[model samples]
Target: MFIQFLKENRYVSMLLTLLRFYLGWQWLTAGWGKISSGKFDASGFMYGAVKNMSGEHPAVQPWWGNFLKEVALPYVDFFNVIVPWGEFLVGLGLILGIFTSFSILMGLTMNFAYMFSGTTSTNPLMVLLGMFILVAGINAGKIGLDRWTIPFLRRLLFKKTEKEQFPQSA
Candidate 1:
């Protein structure tokens, strides 16, 4: 069944590979641009934006936004410092087809977060992108290092099912 699925849906794989690669590359490039801007500072930008909006009308009040001001502000500030680097890493991982699923998962997490905190126009697009990443399952493991390592790691880290142990022996 799995082999048939792959053989029949190979075009789907190609489409997803293209989509994931371009999106990932775009994200990484954006992060690189931010880092190279010299004036770019995550903490300063996020905190300044938050401080500027503390009592003003916010587009949305994602639960964490309030916590951001109350308890997470400092961490938010700290995150700002690292976010560009994180974006770059995630993007690089996805584009290189290494840890493809993991990278998409991370990207989806960020997109979902954005979807909740912004105006409807931007939010829906991000939400759609996240859904695409999830549904496409574009791991591309066979074409990359993840193929060589992740299966072994999974076996070491997780319990094998009876089916996995027995396979045709069942």
Candidate 2:
């Protein structure tokens, strides 16, 4: 099946590596830009999203807008810190393939948040590419650090306990 091919195919993994690099670069640069600027703020953006809930066809739904106004706006300081750092970390993870699936999921989450806020930009395209990387799963990161980290983590987490390993005469 197509899903199997995406998950298991070496060629698909190779292609995914390329896409991962592209997405990673985009995120790193965007985050770096904000971080370096030292003036990144989400309050204005949140306010705009809330305002966008009006008009003939609202770009942002009232429910999301209300959440933004009530929850997000009140927590603008937190958003200001996390947005840039989260983007940077996601980008780094994607580029290094250290935690490819988690990185892609985080990136997708940010993309969806941006879209929900009515800032389309390249978020949709990034989401599409990210979904492919997600479907490809471990294979997508096989060529990178996940090659060793995943197996190591798996063994560490799943290793048998002392009782299980040394169960004897009872």
lDDT of 2: 0.94
Q: Give the alpha carbon lDDT tens digit for every residue of 44-147 in model 2.
A: 99999999999999999999999999999998999999999999999999999889999999999999999999999999999999999998899999888999
- Per-candidate RMSD vs. true structure? 5.6, 1.2
Model 2 weakest lDDT span, ten residues long: 9-18
RMSD of 1: 5.6
TM-score of 2: 0.96
Q: Tens-digit lDDT track for model 1 on 1-170?
A: 65345434756566556766776786698778867774555444344434543356665463555555565556665666566777788788867767777777777776665444442444355446545555545344344556667777777889778888889852
Top model number, TM-score: 2
Candidate 2 regions with alpha-carbon error over 4 angstroms: none
Candidate 1, position 54, lDDT? 39
Judge candidate 1 at residue 122 and give its lDDT: 42
